[model samples]
Target: MSKLPLDPDVADVAPTDSALTPYDNQHIVTYARLLQAESEGADWREVARIVLHIDPDHEPDRAQNAYLSHLARAKWVTGQGRLLRGAGSN
Candidate 1:
């Protein structure tokens, strides 16, 4: 896999591939961040702005879709044995 980006350029909607993609590899950190944010009870709007970089205020539907899809992929990845890059490991 190519070196994972520290910050990925997010799609309007994250990939729909059930299997992992290059996008998945590049976004492992983003996935982890999303899961962490959700677990912390962060608001979807705030998480969307911070993690996905989509302004929910301007585009609520797009932001929500990106947030949910990426979050789902994150859960799937962890369940399928992809290691998270660990908190604060950088």
Candidate 2:
């Protein structure tokens, strides 16, 4: 499967500073959206549609999983991604 679910060009995974991945560099907006959703206590289904572009009602498992996975990666980027701020900078 592609590293990014919706947009292949936008990376969705995160690696280390020295070992940078495309997802780590391209998913900044997505990561920010996840953080904002968490802060606002938004629903996962809603977040999936708005952020990941996955419809939870149509594909429950895929949508939920994408939301959760992206959110987790986003959180990781927020913490670890900052370490490489000057370089990849999420």
Q: Please give, for residues 6-77, the per-residue lDDT of candidate 2 as tens digits.
A: 343322333434444565556666777788889999988898877787778988888876777777777766
Best model number under TM-score:
1
Q: What is the TM-score of each candidate against the true structure?
A: 0.85, 0.71
lDDT (Cα, tens digit) per residue for candidate 1, span 37-63: 989999999999998999999999999
- For candidate 1, the TM-score is 0.85
Each prediction's RMSD over C-alphas, in Å, is 4.2, 5.9
- Indicate the worst ten consecutive residues by lDDT in candidate 1: 81-90
Error of 1 at 28 (Å): 0.3
Residue pairs whose backbone atoms clash in candidate 2: 11-23
Judge candidate 2 at residue 19 and give its lDDT: 49
Off by over 4 Å in 2: 1-19, 81-90
Best by lDDT: 1
